[model samples]
Target: MYRKIFIDDENAAHRELSIYRKGHVNAIRLNDEGYFVYQSLPISAHNYAALFHYNSIDALNALPFISETKNGLDSWDEAYLPNTLLEKLIGILGDELDAHRETKPEEIMLGWQDSPEKISYWRVISPTEFCSFLESLMAFVKEAQTTGYDLEFIL
Candidate 1:
């Protein structure tokens, strides 16, 4: 129902990792035979990236929301945010995130999934607001990296 994003240290051995759903253990095993396994941080770590993109913008925007039919993939539960968007987000949200960490207080997280009363606002966000929100997410990733985190998208 929901996807998770993870951040960890960069591993030169395994520069890229394959993404799969929780139930696709068998598929992962089959695919793993072809590549060398690289050790990663334990999943229990509080390193899970909290990035989220609402379904509305995902459906209309040209972002990297993976499509099973369009991309000839087998699962609908996995996707990745493209690197370009990721970098842009990091640049936009860096300062805000740093301030949040220093303050340790409740923050207003914006997204296209705002409450029904604010539905009109989210609907009009489309490309701009959504992009800003994504930048915040990328900022989270950048912050995590400074503390020894790498990134992963678990859908």
Candidate 2:
């Protein structure tokens, strides 16, 4: 069984995104000090942005749309891969695919944490949780999956 954790306060939520995508499979890890951001122009007028805080390259691969490209690695960090590897990865992430039309909200504040710092600063955050946090949520997901309710989303 997967572990389940709660993000009940400010500190936990702040570290949620970065920790969730730490080490996945084929995703890239760009260094932004305190953040992970990915953007694309999908034939649309405005570019979409997905930001987070990740731990390892494998965790990054679990991101949405990263597996439907031409080389699979276009979304991966080119700086970290060889020329041949980059080409192969791009093909995997950007293949012949239509743009996604799902209109889920950008920010989802699942819950909060118990911090003595402030009055639980209310703010929106990514849908998934960090490593420490996801262990708990994953359990909920497993249960939900049995009920035919899927709650997967991309930043």
Task: Name the candidate that leads on lDDT.
Answer: 1
Reference-based TM-score of each model: 0.27, 0.25
Per-residue alpha-carbon lDDT of candidate 1 for residues 98-129, written as tens digits (9 for 90 to 100): 43343322222222223333321111112333
- Strongest candidate by TM-score: 1
Lowest-sum lDDT 10-residue window in model 1: 20-29
In candidate 2, what are the lDDT values of residues 99-150, reduced to their tens digit?
A: 1223233443333345533222223333232322333333433443343332
The residue-level lDDT of candidate 1 at 85 comes to: 52
lDDT of each: 0.31, 0.29
Off by over 4 Å in 2: 1-79, 95-103, 110-112, 117-155
Query: Which regions of candidate 1 fall more than 4 Å away from where they truly are?
Result: 1-64, 67-76, 92-96, 105-152
Q: Give the TM-score of candidate 2.
A: 0.25
Position 63, candidate 1: lDDT: 41
